[model samples]
Target: MYKAYVFVKRGFVSMLSYRMAFVLTLLGTFVGAAQFYFMAKFLGEGHEFPLLAPYGGNLMGYLIIGTTFMSFVGVSLNSFQGAIRGEQQMGTLEFLLMSDTPLHQILIYSALWNFLYACLSTSVIFLVVVFVLGMDINVNLGAALFILLLSVVCMSGFGLMSAGIIMVTKQGDPITWAFGTLSGLLSGAMFPVELLPPFLRTVAVALPPTHALIALRKTIMVRAGLGEVRSQVLALLALTALTLPIGLVVFRWGFNRARTDGSLAEY
Candidate 1:
């Protein structure tokens, strides 16, 4: 816990050190939300798309929730890989590996600050949409949080896998790319999955984010209880069960291979 706090403190200080960048990032959050707002307005207020029936048919709110929730998902998916990449680039990876801390723990701790910042950014988006844009949300905070927790765990499995691959490849990873691109298009990030062709819809179901966005929207928009999203929750749990072990095994292999090849500091 103290180690996690140190990482968070370092991240906070690092972010504060770049005051202009930090401010711009916050500003960018609002800009992104506004862009969605206008796009939603362009579609006409209260315009009901047949596919968005489960989400109460509010496009703006749907987009806002999708983007906001996915920001956290992005953090979960990218932060570990980013941490590994950053350490390698900074020539600190070898030194960190030599320390008493385990590499996996280091990677996990390194992302704490990023997850915190993501929370702040998502908060800004939610505030703007709900308070300023007058979007309605009947959020069951507990259920929403539970779904998010599961989603993060599911995504982190992939993050660990990506981080491991980066340890060996020292280049862009395919796992992150696949999820970032495919999930954006197929996971109902900006639109409904129901709008997709039948085969595409089947493909979307295989992605964790597809289930996450669906459950999150239902929970936030319709105040669905945990039981109401049982299938999505179960799906996330199964994915987590399947992916996390593989991620750990892959990470172990990559970590050992990197150590044996003495490539930790090469990148």
Candidate 2:
């Protein structure tokens, strides 16, 4: 029991030790959000999307929320890659591995709790968007929460998997870019997917976030019921299934490889 407390305490201490980095992280994320807001305000002038008509309005508010939430989702899921890099840098991966408790359980709990903390902190700024900036956000309370939760979990699975890759090769830029850019370009964050070439639109739907962001547009603008979101829901479900299991499986393999190589403690 006391051991569990020590683990939690250690994680918090690690987070605090990098206070400057954390501050930079907070500020940088806020700047990114602001950049998106301005970009949307620019493109939104004197134009309309036909698909957005089903949602009964423009996509500006939807873009604000989508960009904000995707920032969370993108960073959160890819957290594992960054985390493994840190562990390697600390030169404590092996020492930590030697702990009495199961390593998987410890890592999962620590990662998840910190991710939740990120979500809370990010959401505070999101509220500022609607209130301070005076954006007309037609928020649907229930659907917003539901879709947000769905997005978070889906992203986490990707993060854990990416971390596993880092565990093996200690490199992640390629994987991160593969997932991040693909989602960014095709997921309809800045504009509708239909604007992309037909081939790109098809590929975009293959990315669940494409559907997820569209669903968010509908729920916030049209007050879409959960029933109205089967496509988005199913897409997220399928991606979650693929990402989580594969991530965990690869993570197990990577950890074992690190152990055998005596590189578990490599920084």
Candidate 3:
């Protein structure tokens, strides 16, 4: 509870400090949505001489949502790195490792803060876009929330996997590129998987964001009910069940190994 409240407070304060950043982020997201909306309009209208109609007419709305919600996945992964780096820089990294509080809880809470803030922030902007763009997809909020809950579990688990790497390697640059490139391309942030090549399609399916995007699209674009998105829901559940705990365990091992190596704070 303390950690949750701390993060919530910090998120609010951080937002206050960077009001323009939030606005620009929302604007950029909206622009991306508009670009896709046009592409979908042209191609899906069956007047574009042929290309990407395998994606369905709702592709634009899918693109809009899939791209925007990706920010939350990015957040859940590196939540601990920032605070760890800060503590390390201040010579408290070792102290944290030595403290009574479990590192896993710390990491979980840190990611929770990130996921919570990103989701809450994006949701507001998403609503604004819905109103502003006049998007007409049927949205079942309850189903969407359930899918989102599952996606968060999967995403946060993937994040912990990355955190495991960070704990041992003390390098976030590689992690950044890994998340950025895959999240941008493989997740179909700008287009549907059907629009990608066959080989790329295989790789996209391996990503958690792929299912999250699909689930999100189902709820928002096709407006699929929980009963209808059984596959996506199962994908999310399976990913979360498999990956999240493994990530936590791997991160725990990494942290302990680093401590043994006397490099817990060494970047």
Candidate 4:
């Protein structure tokens, strides 16, 4: 935990050094939120849309919840890989790998700051959507938080998997790219999965974000309790159980392979 704190502090310092980037990031959050707000208005409330019936029939609310959750999902999916790639680019990955710290811990600790920043960004989006944009949300804060936790853990498994791939490839990562593209398209981030065709809906159901978004929308938009979205909760739990172990194994294997091939320091 202390290591995580140190990493976060370092990241904060880094952000401070890049004031314009930090400022632009915050500005982007507001711009993104406003875009969603206006897009929903242009599309109408969607109360007449059958696919949105279960989610209180509010287009803005659905979009806000989906986009907000996906923001965290984006962090969880890319942060670790980005950390590893950044370290490689800086010629520090090998030294870190040789250290006493377990490789997994190094990667996990490195991404901590990204998750923290994502939380800040997400809060900004939510605030802008609910207050500045006047979007009404009947949210169960406790349940919403729990769902967010589960979603991150579930998605982090995939992040670890991508991080492993980047450790070897040192460049393009098919895992993150494929997941990022497919997730945004099929995970119902901007629309209800019910609108998808049968086979596509099946694929959408298989993605972690789909379940996460459903649970988030239910809990945040309809103020549903944990039990109300228990199915989505269980799906996330199951995915976490299945993916986390696989991610660890894959990462360990990649680390060992890179070390054995004397390519750990190669970029």
**What's the true lDDT of residue 254 in model 3?**
74
The parts of candidate 4 lying over 4 Å away from their true place are 45-47
Clashing pairs in 4: none
Ten contiguous residues with the weakest lDDT in model 2: 108-117
Best by lDDT: 1
**What TM-score does structure 4 among the candidates reach?**
0.95
Task: Give the residue spans of candidate 2 off by over 4 A.
Answer: 1-31
lDDT of 1 at 27: 92
Q: How many residue pairs clash in each candidate?
A: 0, 2, 1, 0
Alpha-carbon deviation at 165 in model 2, angstroms: 1.8
- Better model by TM-score: candidate 1 vs candidate 3: 1
CA lDDT scores, all candidates in order: 0.87, 0.72, 0.71, 0.85
Full-model lDDT, candidate 1: 0.87
Question: Which sections of candidate 3 miss by over 4 Å?
Answer: 18-56, 86-100, 173-176
Question: All candidates' TM-scores?
Answer: 0.96, 0.83, 0.81, 0.95
Per-residue CA lDDT of model 1 for 1-267, tens digit only, reads 998898889888888999999999899889999999999889956466878778887788789888887787788889988888888888888888888898778987887788778877887788878898888888898999899878988989899898889889988889989888888899999988888999999999989999999999999998999999999999999999999998898888888888899887766
Best-to-worst order by TM-score is 1, 4, 2, 3
lDDT of 1 at 251: 83
Residue 155 lDDT (model 4): 88
